[model samples]
Target chain A: MSILSLTAVELGRKIKAKEVSVSEAVEAVLAQIETYDKEYNCYISVDREGARTRARKVQKLIDSGELTGQLAGVPMAVKDNICTKGLLTTCGSKILESFVPTYSAQAVLNLENAGAVIIGKTNMDEFAMGSTTETSAFGVTKNPWNTQHVPGGSSGGSCAAVAADECFFALGSDTGGSIRQPASFCGVTGLKPTYGTVSRYGLVAYASSLDQIGPVAKDVTDCAAVLEAIASYDPKDSTSIKRDDYDFALALTEDVKGLRIGIPKDYFTDGLDQNVRAAVQSAARLLEENGAFVEEFDLSLVQYAIPAYYVIASAEAGSNLARFDGVKYAYRSKDSKGLHEMYKKTRSEGFGEEVRRRIMLGSFVLSSGYYDAYYLKALRTRKLIKNEFDKAFEKYDVILAPAAPTTAPRLGESLIDPVKMYLSDIYTVAVNLAGLPAMSVPCGVDLKGLPIGVQLIADCFKEKNIIRAGYSIEQAVSREKCEAARAAESKATEARN
Target chain B: MADIITDEMIDYVSILAKLELTPAEKEQAKNDMAKMLDYVDMLNELDTSGTEPMYHVFPVSNVFREDVVVNGDDSEGMLKNAPERKDNFYKVPRTVD
Candidate 1:
């Protein structure tokens, strides 16, 4: 098999066995990027020289038995929002287009310490404010499954890179479905660990409370392995959880027997495409056939999730984004007359339309007369949404839902109506609000040949449940496909006879 | 929801956000914000009587630690990306005469 086709763990094993050198692996992915990236725009930057230099050093460490992790010497991409020292870490916005951090994010540091080679930064939504990567200042990342369709955002580039084999796996931040939706669109596996499971030290603050960095990979096993490499406790981020166990790979059992999976009835209502519904239902049935007790349950407050998420996320974004001015390490306006003018002109010139809209919304919600009516009410609504999820978890070990209402939309369709783009996040946003662990695993392809993802959600810090269930779902889905393909072949032979 | 988002409101909020919008941009912002506000107003449908606002998803607060500095002053490294810099400082527009 081509070295480019190997999963990260497979490549790592080959590198360890000396069958595949780290340099060869890095070279293979870089060559793939050179071939495919122009068409897909999967990456904002590709670090060819740096990755080659790191591969040489990492190969030596592997040879000396100093680095022995499963991800060691594996080439991986990082979402642009995550800081990587000296590598241009634009958060898919002109504001920080030239900005490179002096230090790496805690997640990046953890991955590097595990011996993963940095491929480069992937594209994302500007300040991670939009649902489609079309908002990127660099360029939109197209779905590898179908170029006309969008790879969902703001981790669109990360998911697209994995789907196109531009990298073995990638790290993506999830704030209101940024990672999961894109993963679903691009037909990849993405995990949003329980809030605080992964430290967000250097992840550019979109909505600090909702953001968690996780993995986008080719399969559940790679996602688990990547998550294991990055999930950690850090003193730098106060929200970082000190977990008792970080061994996510141990949860990769293809057994869902007796696992209680809830199908939120509210999620299956109107606006869901029929193909997506059928595919997701098939996933549920597959899990059920594996001895999982799947049942429809009322996950109330579904409609409130979008509104509450926007209000709270935008409020936090407004505050978090206030740091960008003319003086610091971001783009500054040259036409400003004075200090106030500079700040105003710089932000107006630097930010995109969607980002500017969110900041304004945030400021309006937090304004004095409206704070109690809007901001406070939204927070209270958030508590109610979290309460509903908490109540659901009391019965179900894992909740099953469609990762998105439909398959990837054609480019420029969702962006024209911002609210429509926001509504596409209905199924995934509540998980972020409740700080639960969720994943999007590609279950089946749609009529248009776009992939449909089934989201598996577990209670906070119960990543093992989702991981275990996700693995079983992957196994069952793939087995069903094989059986169907064989049946088709036999039928064709019989017809000829 | 009432149509409360006006041109004046957009201008005021943009100023608060430290953004200067063009006339066309302001009109677009006004329209977009009005739509978003109308949609988010659906939250008022749920009666959240006496429910405390969930500021943090996890119950973490006041995460105090040792006062010792972990990262020493790397002024040169920090200043490396500054848009305009003077000797050992990030230079900005003059605020005072």
Candidate 2:
């Protein structure tokens, strides 16, 4: 296979064994980006010189035997929201279009320390305020599966880059399904680790309580390996957690024996597309055949997740985004007479329609009369959702559901009606609200040729359960493909005879 | 609650959000906010009477450390991207009338 076609771990192994040099790998990916990125719009910025420079340094370290990790000398992309010292980190917003960080995000720093070469920054929704990348000041990233459709947002560019082989792997942030939903749409693997497992030090905050940095890659193993490399505790971020185990890759044993998987009956109700529902259900059945005990259960309060998620996320987004006041490291209006005018004009001109709406909603909810009615009510409902997940986990090791309600929607289909877009995040948002780890693995392709994702969720810090289940599901899917191909070949031979 | 998203409400919230919206944007905001609030009113269906509000996912309280600086300051790097700067400080519009 071509170097660009190899998974991140496969490429890493090749680089470590001298089968492929780090520079050669970096050059291959840059070449791929040069050819296809304009069509896909998967990147906000591609650091060609930076990637080449880092590749040379990483190759030197590899030769000297100083850096020997699985990801050492591997080239990767970063979502724009995660800071890269000199790269423009716009968070897909015009407010900070020219802003560059003086330091890297803790997760990016961790990967760099492990000898991973930074390629560039990917595109995202403006302040992560929208489900589709259409809200970005920059243009939307097209789904690699079909250019007419969206590569879900706000980590759409990261997932698209991985799917299109523009990067070996990419880092993305999840604050209510940004990573997993896009990963699903792009037919790649993405993991949203339990909140606080990955430090959010330099991540452009959307919702401080919900944001997390995770990996998007070609397969479950690459996702696990990338997660293992970046998951770290940092004193810099007060919410960062010190965990006992960070060996996420070791969970890829492809063993689902006696695994208890719960299929939430609520996820299969109205609004879920029949094809997407069947794809997830069949994946669960495959696991059951592999000795996993799968059962349907009532995961109530599901209907409340969307309303609560939007309220809490918008409220926190409004608070977190208040720092962009046209003073420090952001665009300032030229036609402002006074300080308050400067703030108002800069924000009004800089932010997009979706961002403005969310901020306005946030202000209204947190205003005097509605704080208890909306924001507090959402928070209380959030606690109830977490309690439901906790109750479900007591009887199940992992929860299986569809990553998105349907396959990737055609571009312009979702943006017109914002509430319809929010409803698409139904399956993935509750995982974030409960602060749990979830992985989206491509299970099957729909009749329209778009891929469907099966989400594997585990309770906080129990990443191994979901990772193991995800790996097994991937294995079973690949085996089924092989058997189908073999039968087709035999049928062809019989026809020839 | 039906007509809660009035022009007055949008104007008040826009000021609170520090956004100077045009008349068209204000009208659009009124309609959108009304729809969103109508949808968000669904949360009222659930009676969360005794549940404590979860401000954060974890039970983390005050995270304190010894009062020591870990890294030296690079004022130049920090100010490099400032929209307007003068003598190691961000320059903003005149606040004093």
Candidate 3:
């Protein structure tokens, strides 16, 4: 197998043991990108020459007997919204088409410090606003599994890159399921850490309170390893939670005996596709077989999660995005009557339709007369949802649900229907609302062969619980695939005899 | 409950958001905004009379740091991304004019 096919953890071990040079591994990934990224469109910018230089430096350190961090020499990709000094960090928006940051995001720095060579910046929804990457000004990123379908958005490029094996791992920012949903669509493992666990210092703000940086990788183990490398408290981020050491990779054990898992009834109702429902149901049963005590429960407040999420997210996005007013570092309008005209023209011309709609909605909700009715009401509803999760966690160690209502939609299916696009985030948004940790693990594939994922959510800072359960499900699914393959082989031999 | 978004409301919000929407875009915005507001109006069913709104997830108050400069000014690096700059300052259209 090509070195690119090895998981980040496996590649790290090989690099440490001198089995593979860092430059060789980086070359394998760059070769994969050259081979497949034209069709997948998973990257916005591939740092071909820069990554090769970084890999050589890492190889030198290893040669000198210097101890590097875990993930040494692993090739990685970061979502475009996260700043990488001297690299283009457009949030898939035309406004920042030429904007390059002078500094890297705290998470990107953490990954680099741990010896991960960043191969490229991945594509995302414009301003991380849409559920599908179709809204990206660059172009839509197609799902690797089915090019006719979308790789779920905002973090679509990051997830698709991992799915396509373009990179060993990728960093993705989640706000209302951006990370987990795309991970589901692309059949990769993604984790949206508990709010404040990961620093947001250099991540482009979308919905400040809801946005979080996390990992997208080939499997649960790789996800855990990347999370350990990036999750840290940085003083630069006011919301970053100060912490002691957290070893996420050490938390991955496939033992779930007597673990309490809650299945929220709300997640399985009305809009869920039958195949997704069956896959998630079987995932829950698989957990039960592993000695996890699973039961159904009511989280009625989840019904309000979508409405509240849109209101809060758009409101913050409106405020956060106000900085791009044809001033300082963004696109400036050439034809402008005055300063006011320049501001208006620049924004209208630069922002896409969905971004404009969100800014308008955000302005309306926070408008003087409507503040109490929309913004404030959503905040209260958010509190209620958090309380419900708090109550549920008292009884259950983790919650299991579908990552998305359906598999990846056709490339442009959700784009035309704005409300329909928002509904795609129904199953995963509540975790962000409640400020909890959640992950999407590949459970099975739908009838169309598109992948399905089941979400495992845990209370604040309890990522270990979900990682453990996700590891169990991952193991069970792999075992079943082995058995089925062996059965097919034996049947073929018998028929030939 | 009726179509709350109107041409006047769209114009008002466009100005507030500093966006110059064309007449065609304004019409589309009116319709899209009306639909989205109607959907978000689902929150009105719940009575949150006594509930306190949560602005931030963690209960943090006035985070204080040491009175020292951790990162020095990077004026040169900051100017690298400026679309139009003169020396160390950003150049904008004449405001007083």
Candidate 4:
């Protein structure tokens, strides 16, 4: 068997049984990158020598019967926003393009302790602000399945690399659907663990309240294993919760007979593409067939979630990014006669258009005159949205909805109309607003043949249910299903050619 | 809904946050402030009577633990990245002097 094409769990077993040497595994993955990276652009930087060195060391340990932990020598990619001590973490923004962190993020630190080898940092939306990866300061990440269409953002590069078999799994931070949206676009499994379930110590803060790191992988089991490695409280992150719940991987089961899945009626609104709606309904029926009861539930409050999220995220982003002045670190303006011109010129030149727009919007809302009206009221409505989900969860084990309103739109399709593009994150943003755990698993494909993902949300700290149902309902039993879902992606590429 | 975060208010906020904004930033911020306030008017119509405002949505609160040092003061590499420094302290322009 070509173990190179296997999921992370299978590869772990092979490495444990001595069927695959760590060097062989690492060499094979590295060779694949050497062969296909130029075509996929899934990787922003390749740590070829570093990864090989780590792999050899792990192989020596395994040969000496000293192999320990669940993920020893598992090669993985990480989104750029999550800091790597020695690597450049641009977070897809030019303001910090030259900034390299001195401290690794808690999640990355945990993965390293478990013997995971970091290969490179992936690309993303500028400060994770866009629905598509087109906004990246680094070149846009193309979907591996079809290079013409974008891989989703802000975790698009991570998802693309996984889908293209560049790594066993990748870590992605989700705030306003950055991880899962890209996973769906790439036809991969991405989980956004419960907020604060994973440490935020190394994350370049986009919106502190909403940012949480999670995993994207080829299957649900791999997702669970990666999550287990990284999910823990860090002394560095005061918001992280120290929980006894260390057995997330052990809880993945097919026994979802008593599971109650909620289907939100509002998610199937007029603008939702017919194919996406059908795929979700079909997946729900499959769950019902597996002895899981499916009930339609109300999510009227989710309608307000996107608007509320924009205000809150923009407000927080405005504050967080304000630290990027010319004095502290990063790019500074030249020929400045005064300190004021220095900061203004630097920010104006360093930040992208979208980042500037958000920063301004954020500053506006947080300004003294408007705080009571915008930021305060958005928080109040944010409470209402969370309350509505809390009420729905009381009746259901999981809430299922389309991850986005449609399949990946053409790269430039929504560039002219920012609102229409923002609406694409309409379904996924509420999970962030509510601070709940959610995931995107491949459901099916649209008529155009781009992958369509359906999301499942659960209450905080109840992330097990989200993955359990996701694993149960995953329809990609064959690689052909993945290829079919990615058909539109390649066709777009051919059209461009 | 005037974008009325004045130059003095902007300076005060920057000081509070330990950020330094420039003069052009102050003028741009003033205009941006007004636009944002104009947009905030959209929320004024929503009836939120008796609705208890939520600061966080998580069910668990009071999650902070007592401060306990876990590791060493590893500043060898941290100081390398600092733009300006003298002795062990970050060097800055003098205000008092």
lDDT per residue for candidate 1 within A1-497, as digits (tens), equals: 89988888898899889999999999899989989999999899988999999999999999999999999999999999999989999999999989989999999999999999999999999988887799999999999989999999889999999999999999999999999999999999999999998999999999998999999999999999999888988888999999999888898998889899999999999889999999999999988988999999999889999999999999999999999986887699996778999999889889998998899999999998899999999999999999998899999999999999989999999888999899999999999999999999999998889999999999998999999999998998888889999999999999999
How good is the docking of model 3, by CAPRI class?
A: high
Residue-level lDDT of model 3, residues A336-406, one tens digit each, is 87888888888999999999999999999999889999999999999999999999999999999999999
**Which residue runs does candidate 1 get wrong by more than 4 Å?**
A490-497
lDDT against the true structure, each candidate: 0.92, 0.92, 0.92, 0.79
Model 2 steric clash pairs: none
* Cα displacement (Å) at residue A123, model 3: 0.4
Question: What stretches of model 2 exceed 4 Å from their correct place?
Answer: none
Superposed on all Cα atoms, the candidates' RMSDs to the truth, in angstroms, are 1.2, 0.9, 1.0, 5.2
* Top DockQ model: 2
lDDT of 4 at A190: 94
What does the lDDT read for residue A246 in candidate 2?
93
- Candidate scoring better on DockQ of 2 and 3: 2
What's the DockQ for every one of the candidates?
Answer: 0.88, 0.89, 0.81, 0.29
